[model samples]
Target: MALLVEVHVPLTPTPGLPPGEYPFPWIEQVEDFLVDLEEEGAAESCDEGTTFGDYFVFFLVGATEAGLLAASSRVAALKGVPAGSFALVTDTEAPEMGTGRRVGLPL
Candidate 1:
């Protein structure tokens, strides 16, 4: 089966976080949320090339039969990621990601 992956690469830190530099300190909290998902076997991190823009360090999580975007979205709700800035995609249209329809955010 095609790997189910979720992208959670936000362009900026959540508004709740204090202003800081690029690769903002609050990014860690986001990763922590996803990593917790991974630890729970909800998803696994992927090393794929799907740059939304130019420079932004984020994760691409892949699950088994279903993409964990919904789970990640729920996590974002608790973690303070901006709802407007968030998005989700799957590999339904392409073997490589980034071509899926928008439903959701980064891993």
Candidate 2:
């Protein structure tokens, strides 16, 4: 079964992302990364309830530990993304994206 990975990216300036303003570009990068994962048969990002308030919240479905780890590495390495940006890994699927564990990027 696949797990739900909720990636949280900051929209305001922070220690991780120096000038976290360009939320659009950052989000586009994230979407592109998810597409890459899907093309590689790694994961699939669901875009039903994505939000853009204080930060960005998106949903990705993949395997367990390894999948989350790989995704984390990619997100952390993103151009404007910060290694401090984190993701919430859940055993459940979308819609109910339940509370699971918190893992830092580049894990």
lDDT of 1 by residue, 2-57 (tens): 44444544556545545564444445566676677778777765554244663233
lDDT tens digits, residue span 20-49, model 2: 454356667777788888898777776653
> Which residue pairs overlap in candidate 2's backbone?
none
Query: Model 2: what TM-score?
Result: 0.71
RMSD of each: 4.5, 4.2
* Sliding window of 10 residues with minimal summed lDDT for model 1: 48-57
Best by TM-score: 2
* Error of model 1, residue 105, in angstroms: 6.9
Candidate 1 to truth, TM? 0.58
